[model samples]
Target: MSQKKMLRFSTGALLLLLPWFGGLVLGEISNDFSQCLDFFYNTTPPVGITAAGYQPICQRYKNQYHFASLYNRQSRSPLYSAYVLSPADGKRPRSTWMFEPQLAFSRASSEMQRFQTPLDQNVIESQAVLEDYKNSNFTKGHLNPSQHQKTVEDRKATFTLTNIVPQKAGSNSGPWNGLESEVLNRFKAFCNGSMHVITGAMPYESEPRWINNRVSVPEYMWSAYCCPSYRSDLPEFLKPFFPTYAAVGRNDRNSGEEIVPVNAKAGASVRGYDVRRMSLEALEGILKQRLGMPITLFHGQCQ
Candidate 1:
């Protein structure tokens, strides 16, 4: 079956099972944002990565589905953002940098206009406001990069602050960006099926780091992709990448290399922010150790 057809079938099955799956009504929630999970396959989101005060966000813009985010209220940043890859259209939209109203107000009372403005009395003052990133050393890094999506709208939908995290300039423009491009190129060339990608953050072990004491800074950034259908005749270098692959990139240069080791050849600018590619199982092992619990990013390891 084609990837498009498989997506349709999965969505249909979700709708059919929605009524009996849980007492929760799909569209009955007053907030339109509540329907965000409808974008996920079978309406099943990632599991085992959430922490206390973390909220799930189904990112929608202009009534179009974009991506899903697991946001940390305390950290005032996303734990991760999940989205499906689409063929690139070569048109990048300017970042509008919007906020999530539901993060500040009750879902029923949250207004669309709230997404455009900064909240004055938000419970989590650490919430990353646009002003916080201004003149700061770090860049507003995107977990679900705009380049992975196809349409203009899809690209723009990724601009919301809810889907962003603090990243160093070296990592954002260097090794990390290279990894995202590599994934896009591989999917466009070899994947004959849908690719579900989840990119996220790993916090420091003992003490938490902060960006201006507002948004929490991640110690490392990690990503994984699951492509169940692909050309069997992959090159030797690309063989282990099929079905599922994962990577972890250093976010802090001063941090220890017990997780992702720094690449000495990456140049002084990005030497410590090197990204390491590994298997799906290896990524999960790191997550399990850091989170103090077993966390699964994809269903059946994207079998």
Candidate 2:
């Protein structure tokens, strides 16, 4: 939370750009998330959000569909990425950042492609490129983090840039990461079936922040999950998180302490990047206030 400029650090090793799954790629974005409907509960996307420049992406990679991202064409960041919670299978994949090629050129390959040298003028103009995060003092935070996935391919597919946001090192590696780990444990413990999760970024209402004046830096990060089929025998404290639960974490340590209060006792590295857990209804209410839309994360409130 210091006023001084955030120190620069290596985000990751930009290893060789990997190959895309040549066979099963979903062509350019469409009007809806129909291609990746399996990722959503009841096969429905969030309701009440306006339809504008937001593009629906069926994130395809390595011959498989991993998740769905609702990308903002203008801000060059994803509003949300929806996917089914699955158990971790292996170590995190190498950080070979990729891009949804079809987002830039419709006739281009349907699969997400690894960034090449010099970059394409159309690709840079259409979406976020690796250059945006280089020395930008921010990390490429995954909205649909790879840790909450089932297979190696599923985890690697999350490396696509369309599903990332500009997040501070404190937030991305601090409380926000803890929350993701906790959710994965919860899924392993109680959920008997699919746990549909939607993780997203919330922009500041009054002022928006950006990295390299391109990708938007979220003021807060939010997530919600729907697990209709859960163990019937649940402890009292665990009941609330059975069918649904949600949380909002601070991406900016300097942000106000209203939505997520800072843990003064915590280490300085993660001091202000606190996370607040709440009910699905509470999260929806907050989303409505900040987004200026009546947001419903799941159908029938995931009943």
Candidate 3:
């Protein structure tokens, strides 16, 4: 039978044996991907080497860099995830950013060697491609952080233009940042299992430029991360807020139109993409086919 037929048959059979097979499938796919940490990390061949047009949602780029995402919506914005991540260093032997992962992860693998940082300002700016803005009040923001790199050199490399967005200071450093940290902390406390987080900022019409880059990139940028395993500790006070951890801007200066607050009981959605109900395999399939690359997992351990 064809792959499609085979997949269908297997899925049906699994459904009978495993009622939660759907959840398992989704988990497997999601676990296969890593968050979109950098524009140039462990990307597959030509996709890594080529610069393609910008995609609004988490789309695929050159098959290698698949935008595995939790949500996609017309009203909200697009989000992206990475297919692979490795060391990224230009030809310069003096550069330490390329190998910074070594310091961040206690156990670094040789494959991480392929990861390189966006060294040239011109090149970094080109990849980020900041665009026009709609509401001056809103700023482009990064969902994935370069700061995840702990080492001084690795952290600095994340400052590359490719990993930036035009975001309001209040959102960037204030409530938005707090929300990310809170969610991460809560995830560790609750699930006792790893969770993947993909986030993106919705773009308006006008695109703004960052300081000193001499170029403009997306008005809003998205960042995503995954922790397939979580800690088992529990806290009663924190349980109420745990479910909505992935939601953005729980606390912010009310623009009246920009931020959306989510309720854990009712749940929330981004654009049309259901933030709570997306499978990584489905996400990967879409990205891989869209970018025209073979099946290459981007996020999590595979990254």
Candidate 4:
């Protein structure tokens, strides 16, 4: 064939394959949650958590990317919500209290929106809706808190139900809240670059706890952060906190103290459900013991 004829044939074949290739690319984007991890500073998500029923969510609100969460449909809550800590200023945004529509409805897209009242009765049965929290003692505690976000839109995106767990009133309002505030201040003061954070829950070892038998109630709440880059000049007190730090907060007063010792000094309000700060390795050790599985929260253990 002539050179001109050969070039024309090649161009025609390329055009014919474009639509099929586009469809393939779209299919991969729609199906996998790991695709969203590109938003992370190092494109690293936590490892070693149970994979069963795990769903990855790239949180978007008002058409803006906010964060990513590893959601558990079986528990109707997030296993962990990961986000980069931004410089927070001004008042925290009001909680919009959204639910993941795509989680409950197959036809629904991964994009997030507010939960509809009189939820489509068909899909409502499969997941926990807002009504489950009504009259319940547990508060809708955030796994990825709004305070860590910088912008109003980013803060509001954290309100999705997939990122919430059934947290106890005392833990949510008292010690846990204090821990979150402390973390925020630490990140603001020391972290000079991107701060990667993952906050999650731990369920009971032997038996599963539930709210309205719909959402699984976590026995303890845990969080960890990796600040790969930070100020080299460090105060003596803040030295141990560099690179990585972690904590495990008690969610149930009735639970034993093998992992986190109860604080006698905390007084009546927040005595039992105390938050214990520890080295990242210590927290991972406790998780491994209780979860009966080897779990790593950061890549190379954030080293």
Q: Number of the top candidate by lDDT? A: 2
**How does each model score on lDDT?**
0.78, 0.87, 0.35, 0.79
lDDT of 4 by residue, 1-303 (tens): 999999999999988544323211222223345657754546866667665777777786666668888777787877788888876666777767776655655545455666755666654665567888888799999988888888888888888888889999899999999989988888888888888888999998899989888898999999988988888988989989978999999999988999888988777978788999999999889888987768887788766
What TM-score fits each model?
0.84, 0.91, 0.38, 0.86
Model 4 spans with C-alpha error above 4 angstroms:
1-31, 39-41
Q: Please state the error at residue 280 of candidate 4 in Å.
A: 1.1
Candidate 3 residue-wise lDDT, 214-259, digit = tens: 3232333333334443343446654434322234332123223233
Clashing pairs in 2: none
Query: Whose TM-score is greatest here?
Result: 2
lDDT tens digits by residue: candidate 1, 1-303: 999999999999878544222322222223223556644444566667445777777675665557888888888989889889997687788767776655654432221122333245562363578877877798999999999988998888788888889899999999999999999999999999888898999988899988767788899999999888999889998889988999999999988888888777778998899899999999999999987768887878877
What is the TM-score ranking, best to worst?
A: 2, 4, 1, 3
Rank by lDDT, highest first. Answer: 2, 4, 1, 3
Model 3 gets an lDDT of 0.35
What local lDDT score does residue 197 receive in model 4, on the 0 to 100 scale? 89
Error of 1 at 129 (Å): 0.5
| Prediction RMSDs, each to the true structure | 12.0, 10.7, 18.6, 9.0
Error of 4 at 13 (Å): 38
TM-score result, candidate 4: 0.86
Lowest-sum lDDT 10-residue window in model 1: 23-32
